[model samples]
Target chain A: MPRFTAGDRVTVLDLGKPGHVRIPWFIRHKTGRIERYCGAYPNPEDLAFGRPGLPAIDLYRVHFPQTELWPDYPGPPGDTLEIEVYDHWLEPAEPLT
Target chain B: MTPEPIGYSADAVDPSRLVVEGHEGADYYALMTEAIHKILLEKQVLAPSDTDRVIAALEAPNVTWGARIVAQAWKDPSYKARLLADGSAAAREMGYAIKEAKLVVVENTSSLHNIIVCTLCSCYPRSLLGQPPWWYISKNYRARTVREPRAVLAEFGVAIPPPMEVRVHDSNADMRYLVLPKAPADAAERRFDDLVRIVTRNMMIGTELVEPYRDRG
Candidate 1:
């Protein structure tokens, strides 16, 4: 089962490691809404080193508001950016105070 | 200095003695990959027939088919919805198998604009779209597009109004994406074939818009 579903608010994990992981640095630790659940694929990090990447992981399409992503984002308030993120790097976003 | 050794001018060096060889930029990597391929083949890990099939798939024809899909989407609302919902599946139905690496179609609406870039590397929709433009894979484009997309788009002669939202998608993860630019204002009267003719490679990449077809000929 996937860690998240469409419309779920999640924050990317910020684990620093030396690897061939697909998670980009820009979206690390940032919160976003899962736009949709992209199909699962083999773990690329394990596959990069020629290891057997068994147990495919789910991928998600995540959308983040431009304002939340960049402090000086120079676009309309409605602007949004979307990126694909794997399940392992995503965690449930905390409730708003 | 002794009158420079008679007949010993710099240009007098034997033309045959100098090894003038053109270098391939990817020679080393190509050689390494070839070695790996041969080993895999020897071990029966990858059959030669499989290699041929994969190569054929990579070099498949229909490099400009992306434009055809875009044109069809523009003329058909239901098709466009299916494309946005499942780009890879939509492409497959159009006879292009862009599987494994998923495809996402981002639409450029009236109020929102979308551009794509692979910040870490050039992760483009190669199966359906063919190779990306040289500039799309450049370091400058990748770095600047995510940070200041409007500025980069402006350089490509795509200046968006301040009120319009410019959303940039970084193709850094599993799924690849394509930009579906909104049809030109005068497209209502244009034929489908005419619309396809005006769709340039850059328009699908979101660096430019769909230029309306002008019947000059």
Candidate 2:
């Protein structure tokens, strides 16, 4: 079962990991909504090293507004960037505290 | 005969015209590929005679597989819904089994235009489109397509108006993406074969528009 559902707001975390990570740098720390649960797979970071990477990681398709990602984004307001984000990289957009 | 003016050619001097010649299997990557092939053969991981079959398998699926899926979707709305919901299964329904990654089909609409990219690497829906075109894997195309898609698209003769939302999909994970381009206006009246012809590989890549009558009126 996926931790986040579609439309759930989530923020990507910048763990500053120095390895085969799938998350892109630009989307780090940025908030976006879950477009869909992309199912789970072996952690790429571990897989790169030939590890079994068992207990697959859940992935979600997150959609971020281009304007938020780039303040000076030249495109129209509706422009958006969507990418896959592993579960560990995401936190609830709503403040827990 | 005058010397070619010392420097008649540099990358900046007619940049695209500059050609860097290469031996078929001698480039760094090409050599690396050759080395790996030999290693695999030596290790018994790949049989030397299997090369032809392997290449044939890889080349089997081409743009037509994707175009046929799109054409079917246009003909039957139910298939489109299935494609949007579960791309891999929908593709399998038509015999295009996505062995390596899950296929994710995104649609292009009047308000939203979808473009696919792999910022991390060139992850593509090869099961349907065969090998990705050279530019699809180029670093230049990968970087710019995400940040300034509108401009990059302009390079492909695709100009997305300011009002229409340009949605960029970074296919950086296990899920491969394919853009379900909008059918031409006369798609319904047109024959199925013509409909398939209208949906080009570039259209599925989200860089070009599907012009049904562009080839012939």
Q: Give the candidate number with the greatest lDDT.
A: 2
Q: Which stretches of candidate 2 lie over 4 Å from their true place?
A: A95-97, B1-36, B39-46, B211-217
Q: Write the per-residue lDDT of candidate 1 for residues B75-150, one digit (tens) a residue.
A: 8889899999888888887777785487889998777788999987789888887778788878778867876788
| Tens-digit per-residue lDDT, A2-32, candidate 2 | 8899999999988767678888777877899
Give the clashing pairs for model 2: none
lDDT of 1 at B141: 89
The DockQ-derived docking category for candidate 2 is: acceptable
lDDT of 1 at B62: 49
Q: Whose DockQ is greatest here?
A: 2
DockQ, Cα level, model 1 = 0.22
CA RMSD of all predictions: 12.5, 8.9
Q: What does candidate 1's lDDT look like per residue over A30-95, in tens digits?
A: 899999888788888889899888788888889998778777877667777888888888888966
